[model samples]
Target: MNKFLLVLLFSTAMLQAQTVVEPDSTGVVKSNDSLVVQKTIMRDTLKPFKRYKAEGVSAVVGEYVILDSDIDKAYVEMQSQGMSIEDITRCQLMGKLMEDKLYAHQAKQDSIMVPDAEINGMIDQQLQYMISELGSEEKVAAYYRKDNIADLRKDLFEANKSIKLASLMQQKVIEKVEVTPEEVRTFFFSIPEDERPVFSAEIEIAQIVVDPKITKQAIDEVKARLNAIRADIIDNGTSFSTKAVLYSKDPGSNSKGGLYTGVKRDSPWAKEFKDQAFSLLEGEISEPFETEFGWHLLYVEKIRGQEVDVRHILLFPEVSQKSIDEAQKKIEDLKKQIEAGEITFAEAARKNSDDKETRNNGGQLVNPISFDTRFDLTKMDPTLSQQVYNLKEGEVSEVFTDRDRTGKSSLKILTVTKKYDEHQADYSKDYERIKKLALREKQIKVINKWQNEKIKDTYISINQDYQDCDFAGDWLKK
Candidate 1:
C-alpha cells in the first residue's frame, strides 16, 4: 500500500504478486465473518479462532503463538504491498514474525523500557500521512475497517509498540559491532567480480537555510480571524468541524476536523499547546493559543490519562511577499558573502541559518538514509538533485523556497562541496560507504548468532505444513 511509512518496514521491491495457498485448516471463514479483528487477541481470551476449532496454530515462539488468523493477517498485509507469495516467501514472512516475538520476549526478560512518547510520535507521523493522503479521517478509518480515526490510532499504537521494541533491541545487539579497514577490504574482495555492486553517481551538498518569518502583523491578523471563528463556534453556534475544514492550514488534520487521537503528553508537540490541551475538559474550547507554527483553538473531544483526543482549528500566520522577500534578502546576502570569500558558508550558517541541526555543522545536509553528509543522488529532492547535478564541485546554488520539518516555507541555497561518479567500489574513494556495509555485515553476523542462541534456549514449535522451507537458526533442526 503506502510505503510512505517513515521506517524501512516494507521496502522489498516489485516482486511478482502471488497468492498464499490456504493451509489445510478446519477453520474455514464463515459468511458472517468479518475482518474487524482487534489489534490484540485479548490477554485472557487468547485465540479468538476458537470458533474455527479447526484453525490450527502455525508456530509457537515461547508464549507468543502464531495462529492461522495471525498468518492470514500477515498475508493480507503483504498482498496489500504487492508481495510475491510462495512457500519461500511465507517462510520469510514467518521468520520475520518470529523474530519480532523473539525480540519482544528477550526485551521483557532484559527489562527494556521504551517510552510511550516515542511510540506515540511514530504512530502520529504515520497517521498524519495516511490521513493527508486519504483526504479525511473518515476515509482513513474506513480504509482500516475501523469505527473511527481514534480506533485506527489505537491499532497503530499497538502495532508500533512491537515495531519500536524490536528496533530498540536490534540497535542494542549491534551497538558494539566494529569493522576494521582490513575487514572491509577482505569483505569487498570476497564478493564475486561480476556480482560486485556498481556505485551510483553521488554528491556531497551543503546548504544555508533561512526560515521565512511570518510577521507580527500576520500573527495578529490570524489571531483576530480565529477569534472571530471561535466566537462563531461558541457565541453564534457555528459547527467547529465546519470551520476546521474551511480554515485550518494543517493538511494532515484539516479535513479531519483538525482532530488527532492518542496524543501522548510527552510527545514533541509544542509544550505550550500541549499544556493547554491536557488542561481542558471535554467540550471546552480554549481561547487562541500561540505555538511556534501559528495560532490554534483547542476543542477537547476526549481525554484518557495523558492522552488527549482533540480537534482544533489551526491558522498559520500568513506570510506576505514582504516576508518572503526579507528571507530571500538574508540568504542572498549570505550567498554573496560566500561568493566574495568575505565569509565561509560554515560561518554564515552558524551566524544566520534557521535550520538548527545543519546550522551548527556548517549547514551541511545529512543524507536521510546514510545519516552522513553525502548524497546518494537518487534520494535528493528531484528539483534539488537536478540543479546540483549539473553544477561542478565548489559551486553554490541560487536561493529557493523549500519546506522545513514543520512544513514552514523557507529559503535555502545549496553548495556542491564534493562530487563522486559511478565506478567500481574503491577503498580509497568509497571508504565510508564500504565501511558502513562492512560494519553492517559484522553486526548482522552478531545479531544472527544471538538470534540462533535465543532460539535454542527458547521454546519454539512449527506445524508440519510450514516445516519444509529453509529457516535460519536451525529452526527445522534443533
Candidate 2:
C-alpha cells in the first residue's frame, strides 16, 4: 500500500476493524458486536491450545476490553505500516493493546481533558484527506464499511479522542524525566566496546536565499480584495464562514470554514494575526492585516477565558516571473562574488540572505530533528542531500531555485562547512548524541516503572491461550 493509504488505514483502524466483546449467557461472545465489555473472567484454562473465537474477550484492562478479532486487526495495522510481522506474535499485539487501554483508563482517572475542538479538527482533516484521495464522501464511507460519512466521523471522533488521551498520559508520565552529563557519561561507558553504535558520515551545510520582492500594486490588490469581502459581510449580512470556505487560501483551515478554536495569546500563531484576533469583540471583524502568510481578515466568534474562537480568510499576493528572474540573478551574483574571493560565503550570507532563521546566524542551517548542526548524509532530505554530497568543504554549489512546502519560490546557493567520516561513537566527540540516548533510556525506565505500578492497581485479565505467552508486563496478576 502507498503511504497515504497506510495513514488512512491506521487512522481509521478502530472504526472499521475493532470488535468490542459482548458475551451471551452460554459464556460465548457474539460476533460483530459494538458494546464494550468490562467484566472480569477468572477461570483458568485446561489446555493452552489456541481456540480462535471471532469476538471472544482476549483481554480486559480497567473498563476497556480487547476482542480476539482485534489481534487480526492489529496484524493488518502493522502490515499497512510496512512492518515485518513474521516474528511478531499474537500475545505481543495483545500486550500492546492492553497497555494502551491502561494508559487511557488512568488518564481519565487523573482527569485529563482533551478538548472537543482539537479532536474535531483532526477528524475533519482526516476525512478531507481521505475524500480527496478516494474521490468523494460516499466512497470514503463505503471504503471504511460505514453506511454514511456521518457514521464514519462519529467513529473517528471516539477513536481519535482515545488516542489523544493515551498519548497525553504517556507524555505526562515521562515529562519530567531528565538525564545529567554524568548520567550520560556513565550510560555511554556501560555499552560493550564491540556493540557500540557506529556514527554515520555527517555534513553541516549553510545556504543563502533571496526571495522575490512583492510590488506595492500586488499588495494593495490583495488588501482591496479582503476589504471587499469584509464589506459584504457587514452590509449584505453574508456569512463569514461561507466566505472563508469559498475564498480562504489557508489549506489547513479552508475546508473547515477557516475556523480555529482555543486560540490563545501564547499559541504559535502569527503575532499580527493573534494581535488582531484578541483586539476584536465577539462578532466583530478586523481590518485586513499583513503577516508572513500575506493578508488576512480575522473574525472573533467568541471568547472563553484565555482562549478565543476565531475564523479567518488568507490571501497571498502573486509574484511575477520578472521578480523571480531578478531574485535568481541576485543570488547568482552573490555566488560569483564568493567564488572570486571578493567576499567570504559567511559574510555574504549574514548580509544578504533573506531566510530569517539562518541569516543572522551566518546562514548555518540547524537540523530540526536533532537540534544539532550536523545531518547524516544518508538520512538528509533527498534534494538537499544530492546537492551537497559532491561539494567539498567550503566549496559553493551552483545557484538553485528552491520552493518551500507552501510552494513559495526562492533562489538559494549551498556550501558544506564541515564533514565527518563514519566512526565508532566517541564519548567526547559525540556527547550531544550520547546525552540524547541517555535521556531516552531514562524516560523509558520511568515509563516502565509507571506502567508496572498502574498494572498492579488496575483490574486486568488475560485469555487462557495468551496466559502461556511470556509478556513483558505482568498482565495476568489478577
The prediction achieving the highest lDDT against the true structure is 2
Model 1: per-residue Cα lDDT at residue 253: 70
**What would the TM-scores of all predictions be?**
0.76, 0.63
**For model 2, the run of ten residues with the poorest summed lDDT:** 33-42
What is the lDDT of every predicted structure here? 0.67, 0.73
Q: Model 2, range 18-53, lDDT digits (tens) per residue?
A: 233222222122332121111111122232213334
Clashing pairs in 1: none
Local distance difference test, candidate 1: 0.67
Off by over 4 Å in 2: 1-59, 65-94, 142-151, 180-182, 215-321, 339-347, 462-471, 476-478
lDDT of 2 at 342: 100
lDDT of 1 by residue, 1-478 (tens): 1222211112111000111122112111111101111221111212222122235688888776765545544544443334433322445555566776677678778778877776677556556556656666688687666689778667666555654565567667767789977998997777666555567778988788887777789989988998899888988888888898898987757877888766666655778778888898988898999887668998988887767878888778888998788888889988998999999888888899888878888888887545677787877879778768887887888878887544678888888888888777776877887776667557656777888888889988888866775554466554
